[model samples]
Target: MAKTVVQEFTKGLWAEIPPFRLVLGLCPTLAVTKSVDGGIGMGIATTFVLVCSNILISLLRNVIPKQVRIACFIVIIATFVTVVELLMQAFTYALFLQLGIFIPLIVVNCILLGRAEAFAFKNKLISSLADGLGIGIGYTLALAALAALREILGNGTFYNIPIFGPSFQPFTFMVQAPGAFICLGLMLAGMNMLGKK
Candidate 1:
């Protein structure tokens, strides 16, 4: 029993990382990763929804009809996403504005739906919660890594903290839309290589 639980928990970290391995939440992954702060905010918001929806879905798995499972999961996930959006607006208005549409877009993030259908619906509550946490953290870390690279090169700063001397020239392109594709492709390639080794 313990071993099964451990496997379930760890599977999400690398074996099924929502962004890197599964590629389920690319919209937010690519959209909100312009800055470390934005990536972290998006990660936390998604994590909240993932964890809440997973637990709820797991608990109601037996009751929700097979045909309506997707609909039910969406409603649950949307509720939590809305809560996170409102909280961000109330406490971090500037950040919220920066995130804009991507904040609400969490409702449709495939990671949440995939987990609800694939893992949460079949697993126990504890195991589902563990999966949610592992996947959420994995996604968050990937976004943070990408954001760190972009911020450092594009702005000569790391998470708003200056790391280079004033004489250093910043790569203005690193923060642009094209930069997102470049960084994500490189990061995904690196992750795949590392996984093989």
Candidate 2:
């Protein structure tokens, strides 16, 4: 029983990673991944909201009316998102600027809502916490990886620190809109191939 719970907690680290295997919450994944800084900031913010909302939702799972459950979940999620937004804006103005609309948009992030409805709503508080943390970490890692790729290849830097030297010619397009889609798609393909192996 204890081992099973640990498995549930660890699954989201790779197996059910968001915007990769699960394919939820792509908006922030794509929007804030241009820079590693923005990616890390946004990822942590989303994780904070996700974990908070999941805990609340799991605790209130039975009290919430069936008809109004979605509304309740939204309220809980929005409340946490607001907290994250204000904290980010107050402490990390530059990253907040980079994340911009995506911060508030966390209220509607599918991963948060989906877990609230599908997992948290049905699980114990401990299980829900594990799920939220695992999924949140997965989301964060995905964003960071994508941001690192774009930052290194597209901008010739890692975390805004020069990496490739003066001779490196950045791809430039890797940071563009089309490039985001292409990069994510390629990554998804790579993941699929690895999963099959």
Candidate 3:
């Protein structure tokens, strides 16, 4: 049982990473990754929602009727998303502004729904918790890596702190919408290559 739980937890880190492996949760992954701050903020908020919703869904799995399970799952996820949004608005208002609509859209993030239905709904509380945390952290790492790449190449900064000298030139395009797509594609391809080896 312990080994199984560990496997469940570790799988999210590599085997089922949301963006690279599962190709899930692309909206915020692409939109908010323009900066490390935005990426980390969005990642943490989504992580909170994922952990809370997963726990609740696992606890209520048996009670949720099969006919309306999907609706019930949404309600659970939306509740946590609202909590995260309000908390961010009160404490991290700047990041709140940065994330904007993406924060609210967490309710519909396929990762939450997918985990709720696929893992949490069928697992024990502890297993569900592990799964959520693992996946949440994995997602966070991915966003940070991508954001770091975009921020450094496009803005010539790391976490808004200048890293390069005056002689350095920023590739401004790396921070644009097109850059997000290209970067994601590159990362996905890299993951596949590594997977094969």
Candidate 4:
């Protein structure tokens, strides 16, 4: 039982990463990852929601009717997301502004819903928690990577710390929508290449 739980928990890192492997939450993955801070903030917010929703869903799995499961999960997720959104607004107002709609859209992040339906609905509490943590971290890491690339090239910084000297000219495209696509495509290609090796 312990071994099985470990395997389930570990699978989310690469086997079922929300963005790269499962391709679950792309909207915020692509939309708000223009800087490392933005991506990290989004990741943290999503993780909070995922962890809360997963635990609640697992605890109530036996009670929630199958027909209304999705609705129930959404309500649970929305509540947590609202909390994170409000917290960010009050404390990290700048980041809150940067994340904007993407923060509220956490309610729609397929990763949370997918886990609630696929894993939490059937798993034990400990197993469900592990799965949520693994997937949340994986999603966060992917966003951070994208954000790092964008920030370094577009803003000549990482997490707002200037890395490039005065001689370096920022690549304006890296901060744009097209740059997100480009960065994602390259990262996807890199992952595929690594898998082939």
lDDT values, one for every candidate:
0.88, 0.90, 0.95, 0.90
> Model 2: per-residue lDDT, tens digit, 27-65?
888888888998898889988998899899899988999
Reference-based TM-score of each model: 0.96, 0.98, 0.99, 0.96
Candidate 1 residue-wise lDDT, 1-197, digit = tens:
78877887788778887777887788888888888998988888888899999999999999999999899999999999989988998999999998999988888888899989999999989999988988888888888888999989989998899999999999888898888889989988998999999
Which lDDT tens digits does candidate 4 get at residues 111-156?
A: 8998999999998899998989888888899999999999899999
Candidate 2 deviant stretches above 4 angstroms: none
lDDT of 3 by residue, 128-153 (tens): 99999999999999999999999999
- List where candidate 4 sits over 4 angstroms from the true fold: none
Scanning candidate 3 in windows of ten residues, the lowest lDDT window is: 3-12
Model 1: colliding residue pairs:
none
Model 3, total clashes: 0
Q: Candidate 3 regions off by >4 Å?
A: none
Candidate 4, residue 107: how far the Cα is off, in Å: 0.4
Q: After superposition, how far is residue 116 of candidate 2 from its true place, in Å?
A: 0.2
Q: Which residue pairs collide in model 2, if any?
A: none
TM-score of model 2 (CA atoms): 0.98
How well does model 1 score by local distance difference test? 0.88
Clashing pairs in 4: none
